[model samples]
Target: MVPLSFANQEFTLTTSGALYWPGERALLVADLHLEKSSFYAKHGQMLPPYDSRETLERIALAIRETGARRVFTLGDNFHDSEGSARLEPHAAGMLSALTRATDWVWITGNHDPHMEARAGGEIAEELEIAGMVLRHEAKAGETRPEFSGHFHPRLQISVRKRRIRRPCAVVSTSETSGGRMILPAFGALTGGMDAADPAILAAMQPAERIDAMLPAAGKLVQFPLWRREQNLV
Candidate 1:
């Protein structure tokens, strides 16, 4: 985990794409997409059916690593609205245990917008904490420090003549809105969007600069995507 300061709050970025808030003792993750395999299988696409279990186990490991008493999921908690019903018994048990152990908040997203907290957690459309907005998608005109997901940004770089891609947080800073960050997808089965995509840059608008961040061993790697020019009108 590497320390990152945003919205005047201290946070630790885990290599696994989790944000740990030390002050709140909270663990934040995005786009869990649980039961995604089952959702695909329903449409005649066969995939390994253990995605939910794997995701749940990772969440549990993150909690243990951070000693977090609270958990905030930035949407897409399940693959679909009915995904909760498709969770295997063991995965369901694991989820129940985690929720019971911590204060879990499921921020509704496009995929699971009308989900119920049947696995023992609170449901919310979004959350505000320490002046930072937490949501599933970035509001184009929001003028406050925000943390969100949905883009699943990834940084693709070439090292030693080999292409390497890693999940990353897309962060942008603006004089009006403070700072906004989009977290990488937490689901093992989730796909990634390029961190430098124009759509992503436009979403995090009103920014002086934008960068993709990845936590490495004792350091945070930043790849700048955009920067306001001094001579641009």
Candidate 2:
């Protein structure tokens, strides 16, 4: 884990794509997409059926590492609404244990808008806590400090002639509104969009700068994505 400061709040970013808030003793993860592999197999794609298990294990590890008492899943808790019903016994047991051990809240997303409490967590469309807006997608023209996940932003760069891609958090900072961040997908089977994609940039509008951030070797590395130009009148 590495230290990260956003919207005047200190957080730790885990390599597993989770954010730990020491102040709140909360662990925030985005895009769990549980049972995604099973969903694929339903269409004859034949993916391994252990994605939910792996994802749940990671979340468990994160909780232990952070000693978090609250677990908030930003969105897309499952690949689909019926994902919980298809969970294998072992994975379902793991999820049950975790939820029973903590205060778990599932913030609904586009993929799992109708997700229910059968998964053992409270369901909510969005939340506002400690002056921060938590939601599934970044809303255009939102000025408050916001944290969201949906785009699964990834940083793609050519290093030594080799194209390397890494999951990253895209943060946009504004003079008035503080900052907004799009967290990388935490699911095992999630895909990503370019960090600097126009759609992402546009969603973070009214910003003076945007950057992609990730931890490397216990340090935070930032790659600038966009910067507001001066003297543009």
Report the Cα RMSD per candidate.
Answer: 1.2, 1.2
Question: Model 2, poorest ten-residue lDDT window?
Answer: 224-233
Q: Considering every candidate listed, which one attains the maximal lDDT?
A: 2
The per-model lDDT (C-alpha) reads: 0.92, 0.93
Q: In model 1, which runs have C-alpha deviations exceeding 4 angstroms?
A: 230-233
TM-score of each: 0.97, 0.97
Question: Ten consecutive residues with minimal summed lDDT in candidate 1?
Answer: 224-233
**Candidate 2 on 26-67: residue-level lDDT in tens?**
999999999999998999899989999999999999999999
Which regions in candidate 2 have their CA more than 4 angstroms from the true location? 230-233
